[model samples]
Target: MKISKIKEYFSDEELEIRFKSSTNKRIRDRWHLLWLVQALNYFADDASISLGYSRSWGYYWIKQYNMKGPSVIVLPKTRNPEWLEKKVTDEMKIDLLDKLQKEPPEEIGGGLWSGPKVAHFIKVFYDLTISRNKGWNLLKECDYSITSVRPKHRKSSDEDKDHFKKKRAPKYC
Candidate 1:
């Protein structure tokens, strides 16, 4: 609507009353005052302050007030993507498994997966970036121990297979 038309609809007395009520000293928040000032601009006779504000800013305030009423001008909600919040995926676990299996146990650093090493490998090979903690989680999920323990030696007799019968016989007795 034209400024002249807005002024014709609401008299100067009405505008002053609304402005004073909206900009009450008791109200600590500036948002209400901002909305009132913007609304007043639509009908303001003086062209100085109206011309000072950017047209886009005025349009944005007008659009917001029309769509959501005055309260929406306070602040907008903030949110972060769930994927960025934490990394947990089956593909990451499989990638870790493949790397472990392809490399010899001795070749693998520390004879087990270390968080940073696994994270680096993922970034270098798969191009799937992840944090050290996430890599540790993947190892834990796969039941791979981080400790450095030598492979146990087995006796020839035990490998020959009568061990099951010998062990069961003792338990039965």
Candidate 2:
């Protein structure tokens, strides 16, 4: 099939500079496609094949660049979704951080602070039912670490503890 040549929107030097400077691989590939067609006289099929892209992929970007100029190739940097940011306000985060610093109230099933506990607290106070993972993320943001202390038997006294330690003393001594 016959393919159309890419229109020169920017100079070959400019395309070369864009290809070199672009940090995103996808953007660099698009720039390379333009550079090959406009600067090196490579046909769309060969250029796409060399770049490990299909001819239609090359055609699509070329058509976009030809019509929309250089801006079409640039993608926005990734960030958290707008709704997520909106859902958890700065005030709420500050409050959560403050709550994590203290003992949990009895109203929210008093216990050591944990992912599920934090999630339950949010649900109780903020009316938001969040996942345990998200709750864990909140704990991390608050600089709270989770740890477990060794369980002790209520019946075991200091004498029993001493006897156990004596029995288990290192043989090296």
Q: What lDDT score belongs to each candidate, Candidate 1 first?
A: 0.51, 0.82
TM-score of each: 0.34, 0.44
Evaluated at residue 90, the lDDT of candidate 1 is 69
lDDT of 2 by residue, 4-111 (tens): 577777899999999989898998998998998899988877888899999898888888888877878884334436545436667878998888778787988777
Query: Which candidate gets the maximum TM-score versus the true structure?
Result: 2
Model 1 lDDT vs. the true structure? 0.51
Cα displacement (angstroms), candidate 1, residue 125, comes to 1.4
Runs in model 1 deviating more than 4 A are: 1-89, 102-111, 150-173
- Candidate 1: Cα lDDT at 126: 65
Q: What is candidate 2's CA lDDT for residue 92?
A: 79
Tens-digit lDDT track of model 1 for 1-173: 22422212234554455445654332212232343444554432232234454445445544554566545443442333554644546676786787666543443354446777777676665666789887676667777774556664575565566655556345663
